[model samples]
Target: MRARNQLLDTDEPGRTVLTRHLPLPALHPVDYARGHAQFEARSDQRRRIVGWLDARLAEHPAEAPLSVLSVGCGTGAVDAPLAAAAAGRAVPGAVVRWTGIDPHGPSAAAFDAAVRHAAPDAEVVARACTFEALDTSDRFDVVTFVHSLYYVPDVLAALRRAVAMLSPGGRLLVLHAPLGALNELAATLAPETDGHPQWWSDTVIAELAGMGLRVHVEELDAEVDLTGCDSADRALLDFTVQAELTDEARPAVLEALRAAARPGGGLRLPHPVTAFTVRPR
Candidate 1:
């Protein structure tokens, strides 16, 4: 089954996001980590999410523990730090039940270790599976999909499922990369998507609006340090395009980076992400 595709392109202002196939094969988890590290302003994103989670914590006290479901929690690099932060925020006897699921077993295993180490008091279940594979009827106080929705088989279905899993007054938080200049070039150079659409934030937001849910949109700004970026920079390059580039694709990628070059003697690709916070019944 093709299993994955989304609505036509939704252009952001001042940038033309090419609606061709995204790079093939996607980035390996490790490469994704390295490339994401190049993002100059990720800490801002982390803080915003952690604050949102902290608010979720405030909704109840020790008597009523917060339930959190994290979809596509890979390696817990972004999540574990905040998980540790949550540990400190919890009242002396407060409890948090955290469930994280990712298809990559190794990454999930890593997440298990990190969260267990960081949030010792919280009940942690790190499973290696898709959102659908983790069978549970329990409602969550907060559910998040951080930059992982683009790879899901069905973004809208996953979003819907997350909302359904919410407890009353619960919030669903999603952070996804919006269509931008750097991604525009990558999309143009990449090979077949194998039927998987690299969904942008607008598509997901539109879906949520179609469902009649109120979504609070937050625009985030960041930069990818593409200084000296070249085809040989395999980890960052592969991550930038979400796939291994061809000989033909490399020069064009480099040219695109240069075109967006920073005034200071290197390339700084403007990478923006959008946060969608939805509170449903």
Candidate 2:
């Protein structure tokens, strides 16, 4: 029996379908960097988020250090980049203290390493704990869930939790994908996985609004280049969509990908990311 990490069971059919269909392996940071460019075109959301944080910090003339809480911070992927961006945009005397929480032990360890490498002077704390079970009394200036909300069993509850952790005038930033062509393809290939189930951008926005939180959304246009990618790269891309096609369905999946390919080279997949900022009313 495979081990279960808190609420996520790695051996479950929905989560392990890709492992059954492909040679799953731990991806390096470089692989992920390319993967980001493959599906998403730019980092507009990240820039906008950092810029907003910069302005928020500026509002506090005291130059007090900022505190950030990042849920499901996988290897500090978003955390590191965000810290770097915030540093560049921060005014004098601005210091950011980041706390990352993730259930995966290895990911937490990697988060520590990545954060240190990215921002040598920043204070970063990595904790291995599920978001639902996290026990902390500290509030934060910013709370973010970047492409990590789906892992939570209760998306609404998770949002509520994050919102409750926000300090006065703090912002809750959530970056999630809309129901787009790429997700549609994944659903087509792995209907059993429920890959895109009930967690699209619209649902999140509606949920926040229902809770009386003011929300604003920004959509980022993204594209991926698969021109020179090898079979491994293709497999990695498929994994992004949570698609695990059987031998019979593999042909159809490939055909659909080809249909979405750009005229020149690579696939012109639709990667529309929505960034929502929630503020208490």
Candidate 3:
């Protein structure tokens, strides 16, 4: 039987996202951690999100507790930071209940441990399920999709679901890499494995705008360091492109990636991140 709300690709109506295949290594925690570390050094959007949330919470002084639903939240990297920030804001008896959903069980468990370590006072919940499979009646004051939109079967449908999950005046935050060096390199290195559509930052912005929602975009500048990385790291980087390049392609790929790096720095690829804050009209 067909799922009631399955996300079907427009171009391939018969092909749903459920049957879509993805690169296994791309989801590896080690790769994700390494990539996230590089971006963390360059930008502080996590803190920025905290400040944004603090201001929003200030607007509703009566709302003592804020519910945050994080889709594709992994390892408490971003969510835990936000929780720690929320704890410090100390919104006079502010209780933040954060529920993070990720399909990876190990990552979800790690997230639980990390949140406990980072924000012990903050209430945290982790669910091992994909956002498409998540079943929850509870809505949230804030919904976030941080670097996880690409995996969604249908971007537009997922955005609509995010809208439905929000309370009145609630906000949705999306952080993703646009058509920058990483994506470009991915295309050049492994064109055959680019299964996901090129729905970059602009595509998302336009989609949100078409829905009559208010959207704010902030670009984060960063670089992915390839210097001193071992072979395993290189494999992970190849996995990101969803293609395992051959020994022949490796040299050229490395050359291009390194050439794009900042002068005097490691093979730093320009990774421009975009943050979108969306709200219903």
Candidate 4:
């Protein structure tokens, strides 16, 4: 059985506190760097997604070039690798056009800089706007939301927008680690903390099916092993924990993480991601 922290009585009604002070750990700069580094490291996964899209495009006898739009494309992580893969392809005179969109203030400039640094020749266009904010006149062969769907206030609406932007036979992909089992575990361990919203899985599939889109959902175990990572690589973990937990519960969560860490060792957390591929009917 895991050691449990004793709960303390608080004068405030319906409130309880821990006896010990639990400070959230600070993640190392290296950890912050790893988020960006991991994107580049996952070239094979990017290629697989791009290849899948290419195959789908090939299935149709479309004479025009393939166009791909990546929604919520943060820092051009997915876009850069995808462009590289398309450029390396042997498609005879096949032009691959790419568009990256994000509502993040710095996304456009940051993505442009990253793409120029990585794949200068790639046809990449980026906009600092959300799917809902974008003009509906544009359509694409492939549209993807990579780990950014959760941030949307109305996931169903955002998904609908994505599907609407797909050209005939076009594919819409949603890639993120579902917070199902992990969320349950976290809630069980710490009920005070609000777990991730339940709508992520429920609405995405339902909306896709209702719109007459053929949906393919796959659960992929892409765990990030932080055991060998240094202190610099743990900052995101710390910030994430602190950001998610309330002040009263923050310390306990940090303490829990501290307990998970081995002596003179690093920590490992499960990162199970899910990918949904929806093709027009």
Candidate 5:
């Protein structure tokens, strides 16, 4: 308890409390960052995204600078790696214009901090706004919604915006979790306010297809680490469910998490993420 309290109290400037409890939003960006750091699988996601980026960059002629926009760019964990890759030999003589957006102010600040260090050479801009309010006339060569479409008010509209904001021959990459066991637990424990099933890969795909966009999908396996996790630790559960929960609801949630544990039957979750790639000409 002391340790947890200590962590929450030390918020830097520009820090604010998390008010939205839709698809697993923490009350504090710092708390979200803590939970995010616990997931080793995100490292895998980062590697996969960076590898795909390098491949895409290779295909380009280096005719113009590469522009990348990251929607819901949290704390810069995923973008920093991609920025580093963009700065590498993938596209010689091509600069990477990095633009990131997140409604959370602190997360945006953290993103700017991370990007400054990771890809200092890249032209980076971090904004505290959602894609809907991006207010940008610039088009991007690559726009990514890495694990961020869940909380949007309208998933379909966001997808359309992502597609519309793309430069000619640009690609839109979306990494989202499917309807997995962990989400089922969350759905049972804390139903979303959206009055619909959470937006999984299928939801996004259906929307994209309706818009006549060509899309391809890839399955990526991951796990939500509840190792040494305390259900009493509200931040972890908040991130897991992407929402706020009552103390009364914690036990059932914790039990469900424990059931998915490994050989020891501890608190481990089997989380599979799907990657959606769309290239619109």
Candidate 6:
């Protein structure tokens, strides 16, 4: 199920609102650290994503000098590895460039910094703006929206724009771990209703293919161990909740979060991710 008409007026003129309702938990440092750690420890997922790109690039050897745009590239954890992989490829001086965009002020800065540290020779551009605000006429060899599609206000429109930015034979990749088991558990345990629109998967792919783009959808089984965490991290967890709720509703949501946390340390959480890849037709 896709979200309805929830567009906001942006400071930039003619820019469409990316998201109508923000999730309660605003992006935070702890979450960033946690995500970075996860990526570092679980390099296999990153390897898989890169391997998919390698196959695609190999199929189109004529399309050299890969230009990649990573939408919502939080902290550059994923981009660093991707850049390194591109650099190590056989294509010397192949011009591997990366542009990362994120609305979160600190995240954008941190990602840019990390990119510099991890891949010094790679050209990395970090923009602190909503994806909708990007108005580049140039196309890229690859465009990725990783784990950040759900936050966008208009999923279809965003997908359309991402596809438009892709050069011929270029690919657009969207990676996300939807609220599957987590949503179910949250719904069963909490009073506040939590449900995602079906359009998230079904409509997204249909719309992309309808545009004549070659689309591929892959659902991968993955799990994250959140065990041994206690209420002390309530404040950190609250940031995510606050992103989607009104300020007044935050306290109550925090209480719910506290209830959800395990007493000793952490809560075992299930993670399932879907990756959608599309080539411009």
| lDDT per residue as tens, model 6, 140-251 | 8888887677656667788888888888878888876554534332222222213543234554666676677777888765544443223334433332332334445544
Query: What is the C-alpha local distance difference test score of candidate 5?
Result: 0.70
TM-score of each: 0.81, 0.74, 0.77, 0.68, 0.80, 0.69
**lDDT string, candidate 4, 156-217, tens digits:** 67777787888887888787645443233232342221234334455566666677768898
lDDT of 6 at 15: 38
Total clashing pairs in model 5:
5
Error of 1 at 149 (Å): 1.0
Off by over 4 Å in 3: 1-63, 189-195, 230-232, 239-242
Say which prediction, candidate 2 or candidate 4, comes out ahead on TM-score: 2
Relative to the true structure, candidate 5 reaches a TM of: 0.80
lDDT (C-alpha) at residue 235 in model 3: 47
Give residue 267's error in model 4 in angstroms.
Answer: 2.4
For candidate 3, lDDT tens digit of each residue in 73-183? 877777776777666665667787888889878788878888767878778899999888999998888898887886787788999999999988898888877876556
Residue 84, candidate 6: Cα error in Å is 0.9
- Candidate 1, overall lDDT? 0.70
Clashes found in each candidate (C-alpha, N, C closer than 3 A):
0, 3, 0, 7, 5, 27
